[model samples]
Target: MVLRTARVGLRLTRGQRNRCFGLLRAAGDVWACILEINSWRRRRGEPPVAGYQQLCRLLTESGPGTFAELDTAGARSVLRRYSDAWFCAAARRKAGHTDVRFPRRRRALMPIRWYHGTFALDGRRLRLPTAAGCPPLWVRLDRLAPYPCETIRSVTLLFDAGRLWIDITAELPVATYPAGQQPDPDRIAGVDLGIIHPYAVSTLDGAGLLVSGRAIRAEHRMHLADTKNRRKAVAGRAPKPGQRGSRRWRKTRRRARLVEARHRRRIRQAQHEAATSVIDWAVKQRVGTLSVGDPRGVLGLPAGRRHNLRLRQWQIGRSLAILHDKAALAGIRVHLVDERGTSSTCPNCRTRITKPAGRTMRCRTCLFAGHRDLAAAFTIATRTPGGVITTPAGMPAGVVTHRRAGRHLPGAGRSRRDPRRPAAPGSVGRLRPAPPPSVGSRSSIPPGMDEDPQHTTGKPGER
Candidate 1:
């Protein structure tokens, strides 16, 4: 539940940009040189090296280098950054991976200038040391805090769209659960993840909620196609390994690079929005227990183009990650139950159906007809180890209600009419409250009438 907020980029003059780049390049060069030196050593019969301060000094003692000299703080920070990178690389290698690839000086590579403890924060500016025998550099801010400045560890300067920007890394704070919430034990929710529908939630109450993610997938594909075209155009042009910068070559390279970055960012934002909406709905429903089918296995199968397309639309893993994380913060329990035969098996009857084309799903044995996603959701919702319903346990607390339906005499003679007698204390043995008069629906209640505090049926304001 930790939240990260960023302030818009601050406009920097050309001089300021150069200074920032100077500090950034100094740091990048330190890391790059260290990596190269380590590679060379590994090639020879020499041990791998560690720590870059001594190496930094040796590289810039009295040479015609980009950086005139190295300061103690900058030198130390560079070493620490590379050390962290080395640890990460080691972890990846330990997981049966091969050699590590050091980061290159790409357009959007890390541009960290200030260290965690070395840089001092003025009222509206940050100051850090750099080489090149220049004065200490300062990053001026328009306001004291455009975002939660306290959370930010450091800001890295970056060049994007011919404009300078800063990428701020911050320690996001966790959000607390709201008041008067309890976990619902009796109710379970099944989610059918898809690209077109995004989320198809079938609650114990038999209500289906469809949250469309069409725009999200469409935007992502659009950007992806644009990127592909740009890459193709770049590939068509020929260039030598050490050719000097040409107008067309640089222009195409820059365009391709920008498209790549923008497209990734667009996809990220869409995912955040889609996941947020799904999580919000789950929270509102007070869903104590949630089960999302693992579609990744199916997606990995060698299928036809259309099948693969549908599978791609189902970002089940990503959506599930969002649910799990949000539910953890909210204290709701989430389970990754076996999704095998969830859609094929009927919830009402244990009969399995063969794959049917199009969107409708009809249980051959039970004759239960419903939307395919809704049917899958219902099947998922009905599954549990024991038939007995209990309160859900996990992240995000909520309340639960039990209900049952059975035949009753139309006009049975009774000695005395008791209001509480109809409810039967334990299970809500009856239908839901009839639709409001305005809706012009039947007075008969729908099956599984227990209300969900977190999510409600046909609630106009529900988002």
Candidate 2:
């Protein structure tokens, strides 16, 4: 079984919100306490405590109710988080990475987790464990958890961008299909990951698929433009380094956070949709193994500032991860292969040709031409860590499927327009007449007409 997590927002009353925040703050306090203990130890030239058992012992010795509303389970989760972070930093440092730092910074809120037995999930309501003698705390979820209740293993309470969300983790079995519907183990496909087209796929059967990311790119651009304009508008209100800002500044910051969070959510949902499309397509095509081109090697190189920002916004790592997770659940095996020469190698002539700047690649030697990403994906299919798998060198397939990701994003569909963009110069925003009132209603009278029959718009009330 594989694990998946769904983040669900919380709908809380004032008191519930306060209590939830208290729990998160208590988790933060525990984190700070751990850091303080470690700092003192470091100053004394002692090895810092980075073990869960030791931390739990320390917590027990400190007695119960040390953290307000934080139960033993929640507090232990925080301890585990700190221990994990400390060890992770230590490992990186030992591997000749000096930049990695331990968790020294304190937070006002830290996520707390509770195992299955410690929490109760009933429809939209959740019962969280609290400190001894504290009353039971029940918080409502804005929506039901996506996973089956029995499969849920844990729930994590986290605060993000001024909102409270719970991450529900569940164990799920891989997908199974009946006879003739299951993917054939011998069928293989190649995937080329790119910025414009997030997934370019080709198979030996002359079938191909391309998932466009143009909508996602537009979202990023619009959000970036909006951010620049917002910064400029707020520049005058920004306080000096030491000066305290008024309430307006805080309000502005809060709105900015909400906007940022919404952008992230939109992008995340779109990516998921894209990955789901790929998986569904593969399943329909009965593809069992996917050879994915890994482009992370060149990501570390110094690119121009503009290109670097584009790469960062591309979020290639997340894309790969989401695809992998979806593929795994669909019972498809994924393999990552070097994509260094995939683009330059010609599928038609099997000869080296300089990569083209645009989406179409031409091989002069064989007088062959085809879609660039698809050709690259086809070439990549032949290469694996074990060596090339012999297959028919095929040109770009004419029977290709086109799909668009982020179609639900702002300005993605024709029905919706991005709010970030202003109205056309000298043009007004969208305007429409209100629907006509019911035929028999007296309120349907136009503004120019009088409500009373005697006051009708006539020279002498002829009616």
**lDDT (CA) for every model shown?**
0.56, 0.82
Best by TM-score: 2
Estimate the TM-score of every prediction: 0.65, 0.88
Query: What lDDT tens digits, residue by residue, belong to model 1 across residues 119-175?
Result: 666667766555545687677766565556566676555555655665555665444
Candidate 1, run of 10 with poorest lDDT: 403-412
Error of 1 at 2 (Å): 3.4
Question: What residue runs in model 1 are displaced by over 4 Å at the alpha carbon?
Answer: 1-8, 47-109, 113-134, 140-147, 158-164, 182-188, 224-245, 288-290, 304-337, 378-463
